[model samples]
Target: MASTDTNDIYWRAYFKAIKLQAGGGATEPGMGKEYFYIASNANRSIAASRFIPMATTNEYLYQEADNLMDPNAPLYVPGAGNTSYVQALYTYLRHVKRPRDTLTPEEEKAEKALTQKLKDAQATYRSERKSAMADWKEEKDFENLSFGAWAFKNARTFYAAWEALNTADGALQDFLASVYGADAQKYRSDMKKISGVANDILAPVPGLSMTCSNIPVLDVAEGIEKAKKGDRGPPVGEPVGYERPAYSLDPQYRDTMDRWAVEYDSTPSTGNAKVTWEQGSKTSWKEFGFENIEAGGGVTLFGFLRIGGHGGSHTEYENVKIDEKNSTVDIELKWKKLQFFNVYPGTWNIPQIRETYPEVVDLDEAQKLLIRPTQFLCASGLSITCKLGGQAKEEADRLYKKQVEAGGSAGVRWGLFGFDAGGGYKKEDGTQTSTSSYDTQKGELTISPTPTFGNCTLLGVRGQAVSI
Candidate 1:
């Protein structure tokens, strides 16, 4: 008859072989046993029944799908094929029960509309978050710079220049009123009308003409006209020529001031500085701080300093120098760390054994022989389970054909099965031998084996370490 008795025996054997390989009965080191079982179940279900309906197989596929979808899993693969197995199985089951090839027109339109709405919402959220973060960063940067000492000094200097200009202009107006009367008033009004343009022109002090000449304005204008006309003339001597006058401020003051301002502006406003020192039976860099050092005379030193806070915090050594010419402090710095953490990759391997019936005397002989040789078990348990599945299918097909010829209404169902009553083998001691019991109604397969240690070979392992 087309009974599942032989199928049950094969499944029992498959479970036993898997358990043995996975260190279930042997105290040998192995790959992760649970992971191996899961992988094996996935492989078996796909290979044997093409993921046919079985509570156990369904659960295994579901778990496998989740694992593949997880970003952290080593075996995870990106794409629908790897992550949609469970959903596809569910859809297949649904179709089998209520078969339909396509959705109705209304359903199709609704699905499209929902998909578009979801896409639009996601896009809007991303765009708004990006813009908000950019604005927050800009505001934070402005606030930090505004609170810095260098920024304060620059602002004070700028306002001082404005005040000086206003005072000078007021004095000039009084002098013009005394000398030119109504004409002076007209000049003042014209200046006021062009004040905005004057302000823009005066913003950058570096671009202003600082050189003073004793030559008359009319003579300088005549010289420029002659040069533009390509006239080859003898050099104008003494009073007729222009020459730079010595200023009260030092010659290098302008350059030094410019450098100081640029450096201070670039300095980040938070973090701690990492200092490295050399110790040779003497004091180190970390022990000394800049306290009694002189401010000028071209003295410069290199030392670590912190700048900014949180996202603003910058850590690095700065080239600090006091500019005597400009009576200002100058620094050059960059943000980042000089040291970092290291990382490493590693791997381990376990040896496995797969013996078929043709290569062994019998199941008992094979079990006894397998225990004598290996160390860590191959936790996957797939090698034997796959073979058993093929053998079981062949046996079931043969039996089904025979039953059909005998006019029986029986049919084969590829699912969980139990051994027939009184059909198990016997040990040399006359005791009944079975791996475990199976219940078809509950769709459960249980295997309980005695744990024992065995002799096995070791596998090679390797790893690498990297410094970052």
Candidate 2:
């Protein structure tokens, strides 16, 4: 949200709160944990201050789901004490429940009036916010140039929760079997039964195929995106998005470099301090005064999920930079959940087979893709691997069955096995740890990291390397 318009959806939800803190509104502003809604409301500022950051995953919300019927958690009631603040921050989610129909006409009118109040109050702060924010479209780390982003906060939690629901209930197993398939049950046994990760929010996921995962790659990707967008762009790379405010070393010359201030790495625990530029002024970015950007979250994925192959599910996901967590599926899993019949040249003209194989033998394309890498090496002779775990044993047994079913090393010669996932190893003192950042103090003046924004900074800035 910008100083230009706090009346937008996200900001509008929190405008009154932010404005009250910024001291534009009538009520006395809050600082740090002191921030709270009007005294007449819940008045539980302390609890809210702690809970807001964990708004998405707070166990209370999960318990409140009542079988995960609604995509949006039905728990948050607006203007109440505990839950309303979340609705305020993520404003689009008005406090809604299943029995709860849409807001009454009186409630709608009240909301509209409140919105007008918020707009009126925010109008006074708009110009100031505009001054504080730089033209950030050209910023490199931004996932999409558009300001709105819907990142998967804690997607693993959705699968984990589903795993839990399935495991805990026999009725659910019957439902899954009846609706989805029997083999669907096998997919999740590997999901939740693990001890450590059962409660771990940042659990490492299964590495299937040529997937690249780092610190829960899905979550890291979103954090990196937000960090890039939140910070300024580099000195070099990409043409200026909007026209420069002041320029003309020459009319013929167009500056391609970012003329705006370069942003600092705000990965610090205090959130983005923006120490270089103080907050509470038109000249600088407001201090992001929290630990978590509150950036990630878990979503509810209950009920019958469509299954794949022997029984699982498949979908092609796109545009994740702007989609919610529930939407990011099989992104890294290159598995072909698709089905296709084998086409034999000799049997191609068979009318019943439609120029395909005499028999419509469906094959997993991903299975072929999987076999290609190890094909030559394994065919060379024999191969052996060593690992120790119940999970590994389970996988070995499963692979043995599949390999046997495929005709005992003749049909599928090569084999591949992923290492252990869901790092649930017990810690020494029952505590997980962090090593912390290397902490580089040098401020990035240019776009490039090496020479500090590279050639653009050396030239003091240029427009379009191609143009020059």
Backbone clash count, each prediction separately: 8, 16
Candidate 2 segments whose C-alpha is farther than 4 A from its true place: 1-111, 116-399, 403-468
lDDT of each: 0.23, 0.20
Query: What lDDT tens digits, residue by residue, belong to model 2 across residues 334-395?
Result: 11011111111111011121111111122322211100000000000011122213432343
Model 1 stretches with alpha carbons more than 4 Å out: 1-3, 20-115, 119-468
Assess the local accuracy of residue 294 in candidate 1 as a C-alpha lDDT between 0 and 100: 15
**TM-score of candidate 1 on Cα atoms, chains taken together:** 0.14
For the record, the alpha-carbon RMSD of candidate 2 to the native fold, in angstroms, is: 31.6
